[model samples]
Target: MPCPPAVRPGTPQWARCRAMYTSEETAALLGFSDGGVDEVLINEAHWTMRNLLLEQLDERAQMLTGRHKSLSMVEGVQHDDVDGIAFIGYHAGAGMEGVLAHTYLANSITGVWVNDVRASEGLLNSHVVAEYGVPVVLVTGDDLACEDALGYAPGALKVAVKDHVSRYAAVCRTPTRTAADIRAAAREAAALATRHQPVRGGPFTVELEFDAEHLAMASTVVPGVRRSGERKVAYTSETMYEGIRTFKAVTTIASAAVEEQYG
Candidate 1:
């Protein structure tokens, strides 16, 4: 059958296309029967954890397929209509133990912390959504990833489809096993679907510690970001909204300075 209509451009529907499937699975898990699930498919980005094949997706989904979204992976969480989020295909943060572990720019960042909590992209985005009053209801990844979720999303359901041996290897489940697990978890997570009052936990202080000093030095070019020590940069903002944006800028600058072989 033909895919569901593409999310309309320049509208909130477009934004819905970019939420992680974990959110959709949460909606499904929690019994959101009234059009609550939307799927965003990113293209051409192969870090193994990404590159979701649209054709293989179940019929209940509507996919946003293409490239260059402003917020990238967690694109839809900011929308007022989105109630909760889920982190599907999510691994551990860079420097943490999991399969295909890394944060935003893959290998460039060694670690990121918000209010001193080590953050995965899921964890960071979870904090971002909390500012908007959205709950993370489900998370799926390796065993370590599920453990990580407990620290950030304690109430959320988690399914570990694999056991991590390294960044590139895992004791993986068959697709049949994993898919059933995801579907069941998605169904249950839907019950947690409900928005609450927006949070304003600002001024948020974010600290980034990179593997190299040059990366930290490069991040300092962004105004208000300053070196905290040899390989770390710190920045504060009035809100997590602003804090995350500044964090994005710092990562971008740091990523650009990475040497091909030395970094």
Candidate 2:
């Protein structure tokens, strides 16, 4: 899919930015026609300053837009036909330095771990896709985000569009400069796109540490979830697919339990 072209403030530009870059630099590298891909867009955020810049996509690509998807942001990766996945407009995880850093939920999750490593969304999704033998071909974001990708997908190409200073700020590159870098990187990344062995790492035990006691207690509403400590809950599953689904349920319940004034 072509990356969104219109860069907006405080939003991750994932595919949009990548599309701009690929159009300019990497179009020939991946052996894809200059403009031949489809985009499935999802609006997982509450608000943004500008709409995605769709105009930048080459004539060969098409887009899907709107919100409320079953898989949330990565709705397209699971499709059997998708050859590779790209992490675009990504950022550092919660408590890390990068623009708009957070996991699935901005304030609810304190941390998420994958195979005992501190994970950002890119890392988590990388593991999820690996289960289906999908390659993560390109990652674009702040420098730290690229660094995070290295832990999960070292073989993929990376494009660092900015240098992190704080959660909400960065020393950013202009769209023009970043586009050039991303295009070139993506072309090479495309070469790494072949899928490999499907990985199965489980019976996984997921532990979620909430910021408050009530949040932990609330998570127990999920059938197998249990409070493991004063402010922590844990659940076990036979596969990461089930593990992640259960983790999602726990987060949903915990988030609803949060009180505005005290939590």
Candidate 3:
């Protein structure tokens, strides 16, 4: 497919963003064709390595290697950078009815909330990026995932590649159809990629519901996280930056606590 001319904002500022899963196709479809600036693809190690070797990529990419980065603990985004972002191949939050639904941990986490609003990864990451002035321009996933996004990035274009029939199954769409729809949406969504002033909404209270009682107890190993119930833990952070990383820690410790045949 031929690339479209770059989309421009009123000012000279360029766009930078992040995405994951099926991101290879999403990245190729967007790249500099949809938005003017380069994209920062966030995928697992294997996909990133494949992207590096294929040369199908347009500008440099990024794989969010965790912890102790020179700038941020996760190399997903940098402050004063990234104008817009997209969530690709995301699903419903844990305990939801979407296909392959789960939060950060596959089965350990049953639910998560930020200030009492039930949060999916889309909502949580949206909060993290808004702090740096980044806007969410596009989101692609199952229909429920798109519905879930309305709460987080209602202004962004949402493309539902499939309709959920169950947690592991959906009335899937043809790749050709989805690709065409996404391409159209991506092209139009480029205009929404402009950056804005950073937002500072502080004192975010994050709570997690685990599948097992032990998982909640394990989460308390992270400082500031405490037992909220037999299977829940809660913590408060002054910023989403701290809140997200702390959430990561809680999930990790909880996952490690899982035992075979006993959750």
The model with the greatest lDDT is: 3
What C-alpha lDDT values do all the predictions have?
A: 0.70, 0.65, 0.70
Q: Residue by residue across 1-263, what tens digits does model 2's lDDT show?
A: 11122344344554455455445333322333322333322222222313344465445454444554445545565667666777766877865666677666666666665555676878767767787788888777889999988988898888888898876567988777776677677656666667777888677777776667888898898999987888878878877667667766887787678786752
Best by TM-score: 3
Error of 3 at 133 (Å): 0.6
Q: After superposition on all CA atoms, what RMSD does each candidate show versus the true structure?
A: 8.3, 5.8, 9.8
Candidate 1 C-alpha lDDT tens digits along 135-182: 888788899999999988899989898999976678988665676777
Model 3 has an lDDT value of: 0.70
Better of 1 and 2 by TM-score: 1
Error of 2 at 115 (Å): 3.7
| Candidate 3 lDDT by residue in tens digits, 145-195 | 999999999999988989999765689777767777777787777778889
Better of 1 and 2 by lDDT: 1
User: Relative to the unseen true structure, what is the C-alpha lDDT of residue 151 in candidate 3, on a scale of 0 to 100?
Assistant: 93
